[model samples]
Target: MALLDTSRTAPGKGVAPLRSAAKAALEASGLPGRKTEAWRFTSVRDLTTADATPAQGGLVVDAAPGVDVHRLQGELPADVAGWLAAVEPTLPNAHFVALNGVLADELVVLHAQGHVVAPVTVTHHGAGEGSVSTPRLLVVLEPNAELTLVERFGGSSKGLTNAVTQVRLGANAGLRHIRVHDVAQASLIGALGVAQERDSRYRSLVVSLGGRLARLDLRVRLEGAGSRCDLDGLYHVDGQDHVDHHLRVEHHAPHATSTQTYRGVLDGRGVAVFDGQAQVTRTGPGAEAHQQNRNLLLSEGARAHTKPHLEIDHDEVVASHGATVGSLDEDALFYLRARGVPREDARTILVHAFLRELLESAPTPLRDELAAALRERLPRGEVTAAMELALDVDEAKGDGIEGDA
Candidate 1:
């Protein structure tokens, strides 16, 4: 049975020329199911019936100064097959990638050949209720160039947003990516695909807070020797919110290294899932890969599912992956309580301790914003001092992160 009937559907705005191929890809992969190894634990129901209209009731944000933000305005290249062949052919068969290729709105392109002084920011705000928005971003960093890119998504509207980002790094180039999303009970699906060249470096920090339904998939390939990638994420969901993180890292060249660290905090009846995989290919003999997923559940109703995978097809390589799901540490809680702290304060202390590492490691500009966002979600005083104690409240007096929402 076909996963999707791409028949009778005209090609979307940007990918008009590749309608048939896109449809074929959709049919080949179909929608993943319980039996699908990659998607067995999570459900993408919200995305299958995904709406493509603009969302309602979200703040319109601004990009940093002097950065050119333009639409894909022109037609795709004539030799589209060559472009498709640049990336893996399996892209179409991946979850919603093909559908996105056919349905996405104009893609936003960010290109730089030299070092950029300030970070480039992209914002996704709600346009109305039950409306959907598909945003696409293409980033290219020429060899020896460096830049920072920030992605922010926030809104209270009831809608769905499916976003895709494609990145290419030339040899010796570097990139820093920071993505922060704080949504209401809305549906969200996002995918990021990256290809790195020799000696290139890529680092990403992702923070996701309470959402109705949210899923983020990250696929990174170290295709060049000595290339490196570092991925870190923080997720906090409560009140029946559902969030899932799917990550895959592939080491296809020798002397490559990849590291992943993700922490999640779930309370109320909310549920969270983390599935991360690391692959070391035969060509990658001197590869080093590490992954860890740690989750904390604050209430009996809260739930978490975690899976960490490592596959090595090389003779000389080092790889490790692990997942931990448990409530606050009772020993630490007891220690705090014995020190005269109230029960609530003790719990808060333990929770903060669990999250402190990633929060503190976040980019400087976004740290305070993250602390504020987390504080707002917790019941007032769920943590003693909430803002002042857990985070550096004294410093985050500014209105926002460089006009970010």
Candidate 2:
């Protein structure tokens, strides 16, 4: 089925044209079928739900954590306003629809003037009725410009939130995008689309900690030669929640490169899925691509599915893909317990170690923030061991201690 067909249903009262267009795009790109190798492990039926509606703007926010919306406003470059005005008309109306939380009353645009040292943060809050919210953002980075963006979504509202971001990176521009999703357990989420230009760099990190059901879709195109892109995500799901990450990187130019890594943790009966595909066409000679997905099941009933795929038409290119799904190692657990570590702490330590790779690659400030957030979200005793082991490793490295010496 096409994405437009799926999003064609009537929207809530006062629906805008952009919201309709967003729905249409979703319908047109409807979930992949069984024949689509990339989607074989994870079904799309559960992700294309149509119950989302426009969020009322009056939700109360108790507090906003790890986010500074004002920073976004301050970082907005003068040219960004003009760019938004130019693209506003070409953007499909469907891009404006909110699936669960209320759409922010305002839209933010950041244009790259030259180089941006400070990161801009955008925060979303949901209160009052449990409903869908759609927030829109348009970003443009001029040639040779650089910038960083941080997006945080957190709220007590029990509903769905669908957000769409449209980005255009000019030739040779560089952008670092970080997203943190910490919604209420009852919330559902969907995010769609991002695009890049020639010789530009787009790096992103997504951390999903809260939500009953969450799906993130990223579509990036390397339209310029020598362009490079990196995508990374980490998700922790417990209880009955479900999390999914779907990514597609297309190399349309020669000498382009792309890398993707997505890791997840599931406990209880929670389910998690990662599906990534990298396509390097014949025109993309000398292109290089790599994709990896890893997941850990913390409980007997927990489930995880991962599929990483690569399609290279150019013989001169380098490409590889890998995935793994498994539970905690019993031998490692035993080793820690025999060393006088508490059983609970031992398990915690192992879980943290399992997830440390992704965090290690995350930006420094973002890494610190994520660490603190996970500390609060994880079970107290269950993760203590992991924390202890992490400290030990840090101390060992700091002290220049060699294990085999």
Candidate 3:
């Protein structure tokens, strides 16, 4: 079926207006092509050609004690309804989000009021062949509240998953979000939009492990003074997998701060793309922004494209951006090999080290899980023995070691 065809689908309960608006928007924008600035590096050919029918997948939500989980059946929460109405027409490359409105049966809203120690987890399982799953999530945090959220996405190889998550942070509120995408053979197109109020903080870590075609569009806006945001991402792709990350952080208020750090490991014929931009508007005079992206190409057939940009409109702002795409450290590999480590094991050690820094920011349990996932992708060898040997080398240099060696 054509991705933009809405004739076969009708609005679900309580979402008629949004569905109508989205249908029109989808028709106007159509599918984004390579010439489109936002999709320059990532292609939507798979989406355009897929014959998947709209399918409603189940969501398993493990909510904390102080949090509220609501599924839209009649009318959406006022705030969430308004947000969906506002973003449908303005979000860049919003084809998938608009399509979501055209097909989704209901919206999931998670609300937090006070400090919550436990994390809220949402998991999405894969759909069947010739199916398309569109999941929508909205997270709202009240003033002075704090919470942690985890999202996991997985799907069948012949299916497609298109999801959108929106977050609204009130003044003085904070949220830590971790998202893991492990759709081994399916295609995933996801978007995350966050708006922070005065003194609110939002920190997120994204780990993309598997997908035939995976892409994430992350946009964060610092709208109030003293608001801050930090975005860290890691992705490992191999065997013809394609992953793309497009990030934009807007500093719209004085004293707002933002930082972005991303690392990727690519092997076989895997393709990875990173496009990040930091915008410091005139009103954000005291804003500070920094961005960096690094990619390790493990095979001759692997390809990585990185672009980090800064748009500063005020002289009082401090901003910097950079990106690097290269192979492993030959010296490090040689050092490990000279220590009696085999070639394959040495390569694995160096590859793990390249991604260790980013993983350090993740939660302990998540860090270990991601480490194991990374190990599974690298060349198989005596990883444990090689790690011990590599640690000894680091100690010989009098450098204290951290993370999985």
Measured by lDDT, the strongest candidate is: 3
| Deviating ranges (above 4 Å) for candidate 3 | 10-14, 82-92, 381-405
Question: How does candidate 1 fare on TM-score?
Answer: 0.85
- C-alpha TM-scores of all predictions: 0.85, 0.76, 0.91
For all predictions, the C-alpha RMSD in Å is 5.5, 6.4, 4.2
- Model 3 agreement with the true structure over 1-58: per-residue lDDT tens digits: 6543556663446356557767887778767899888888788886677677777745
**What tens-digit string does per-residue lDDT give for candidate 1 at 1-405?**
111223334234454534445567777776787787766666765545644443222322244543455455336554333333454432322647766565554656566667777877778763345565556666767789888888887767666666677777889989998888776866677788888999999998888887887778888988899999999998888887888888889888999999999998899999888988888878646899999999998889988889888988766988788889888888888888898988877776667656657878566567766766776666544464553543444335554445446
Once superposed on the true structure, which residue ranges of model 2 sit more than 4 Å away at CA? Answer: 1-53, 56-107, 381-405
Give per-candidate clash totals. Answer: 8, 30, 1
| Pick by TM-score: 1 or 3, better one | 3
User: How many clashing residue pairs are found in candidate 2?
Assistant: 30
Candidate number with greatest TM-score: 3
TM-score winner between candidates 1 and 2 = 1
lDDT of 2 at 145: 79
Q: Which segments of candidate 1 are over 4 A away from where they belong?
A: 1-12, 17-21, 46-68, 77-93, 380-405
Cα shift from native, residue 63, model 2 (Å): 18
lDDT of 2: 0.65
